[model samples]
Target: MAAPNTSTSDLYRQWAATYDTDGNILQAVDDLQLANLLPSFVQNLRSSRPDGRLRVLDLGCGTGRNTKRLLLAPSSMPLEVTGIDTSEAMLAVALEKFPEATYHCLDPFSRSSPLPNDLRDSFDGLISTLVLEHLPSDVYFSTLVSLLVPGGRALVTNMHPDMGSRTGAGFKLGGDGVRVRGVSFAHGVQETIKAAQNAGLEILEAAREVEVDEEMIQRWKGKGLERTAQRAQKWIGVKVWYGVTVRKIGDRED
Candidate 1:
């Protein structure tokens, strides 16, 4: 259960090589949830701009997992895609895999960071998947709110407090299996909702709570991740990830 106290950027920089290959059960659950969630989200975006003029932003788009999905996802027109992350190493990998999409190495959460404003109110849709735990719980919704255009939709996902408080995102390093834990704050569901309300974002109805199940466990085992399978087996019926759909309505306070 021991993990290093490394910063989020440095940790992901080191883990970028193995990230996509690792049989991460939570991310697998997230993928399953996204399959159901994307249609409605895409419909909402299309409803806003029927002419197919849509732009999307991906926050913490590690190795362009979801970004690639968006690129390949069926669309009326070529959807403009942009992704941002704090780690240049991860972004490098993302850029190589999906060279069409723009990538920025920036962290919006840092108060001293001066570059995020250039992106304000710029996107038609936004996605920040499983990135909230590394950020301050209070500022997440507000920051997300600022980056979107009025009436624009967003999909946000987080590591659920139930599982995160016990053991959040961590990865084994090298042959020693030295675990390097991502910087995390396990925000509870109520607290997360309260923060969204405070940010004045319009919460949409198509939210999701992803739980570990037999299918996820079987996937891990089939992928040669016996350790992960054993861990997820104990978490059956327990929610490990939460996804929320919210909109940037007429702007109020940022």
Candidate 2:
């Protein structure tokens, strides 16, 4: 996971206030393989624990964009959901939108602080979407397994590193003063699989899919940021979103 840079937090803070109304966030909901991603993850969780209430963790839950959607999804259960993020401004928006669930503003990657001990192994499953790309290699995979119960499951999606090869550049912050050096490193299937194995988690489902935000690309193009626009086009051309579902093992509680 990436270190929490105050700069990044502030930028995200400002973005949080209107993120949901912006073209980018709105596009992600309709663009990302969300139509399928949401339903599938919901069904999987229900299948595994059909009879009980559910505990869920929404990692990097920016302004509750994904959290709001999940909570409102008709397929989801009555959940005791917790959302964690590095941006308080974003968490503020989330808390307002989802008063029913809990929200925490913290850097999951700092390693200085781990998840609350009492909550360890307490969740039935976890869901993190479009948040992994910001994490450095070390924190990205390690923080994931640490948050789950032994038999717990996680669904995560990140910007595919393949974006670099396809468009000459991967994800980057523009006008947003976020310090993310070494943040663009992309994890392939093998690395992700290895990370899960090392963490004693087993892969249940995984794949890369296309996620294109046409309005965002056009917005960049209109702004004459040809480079970013071209890359965005390449992003649409190629499937650059990767996702995976893994279950923690080796803990007998399951």
Candidate 3:
């Protein structure tokens, strides 16, 4: 599949209209995994600051899918969320869906781009789903550290580099019927871990998921794309996406 050579922001702007309805199985899997892991991380944050509300930043919060999930998730303490994305079209849709949450339109990966002063080192937890692949490894790790308070936790999910190499570093129809493709970078698992360590983050958990089960196979089958479903079945045990949970341990150098 030929991927788009456009900038990430332009790609998402074009994709914004159909993103939510795109039936992306990788996104579906990531959401399920993150949902399972977030409560424990949230509980940890609440335990540390019993009197204060937990504040979260949703990086690359396209259409606020993960942002809404974080906001609606059941938690012991009060929660406030802020979302940031580079595409105005994407943010427009997100703002409409989540009017209460703060939204910013900025490129987090830009070296000159700085987060609002009030938000620096202020978040209790941060969640980024299916977004890191578009960012440089160094920028991704450094930005993650800068956005969190000391010992603040972050949950990040991305396409596994191994899988991305096989599938290429961009989007495809995948039986989802969406034609949009974005530019992406493939950062290996060790490369990400080393970047986080260099940024003074302690890795707490790392996991990879591969799904080619009957239900998943059936879903692809339903899309009427026999070739896509066959490919999925062929890569049954191969890692699809990877998730990591890390905590900031010291000051950010960048």
lDDT of 2 at 168: 17
lDDT of 3 by residue, 108-226 (tens): 77778677788788888899988888888888888888889987889888888767776533344553444455667777888888988998899987655454466766766786745
lDDT of 3: 0.77
lDDT at 230, model 1:
72
lDDT of 1 by residue, 1-254 (tens): 46767888888998899887666778777877787777677777777787757889998898998998778767777778899998988998999999999888888777777545568878889988999898876677878877888878888998999899788787878624778887789988777777877887778864567788898788767868786687577789888999888887784222
* Model 3 worst lDDT window (10 residues): 168-177
Collision pairs in model 2: 1-136, 1-139, 1-140, 2-135, 2-136
Query: Model 2, 4-122: lDDT tens per residue?
Result: 43355655765665555443421352334666777677777778778777778888887776777668656545767888898888888888878877887788777678777765667
How do all models score by TM-score?
Answer: 0.91, 0.76, 0.85
- The model with the greater lDDT, 2 or 3, is 3
Model 2 misplacement above 4 A: 1-7, 25-31, 75-77, 164-182, 211-234, 251-254
Measured by lDDT, the strongest candidate is: 1
Once fitted onto the true fold, the runs of candidate 3 whose alpha carbons sit more than 4 angstroms away are 1-4, 168-180, 218-235, 251-254
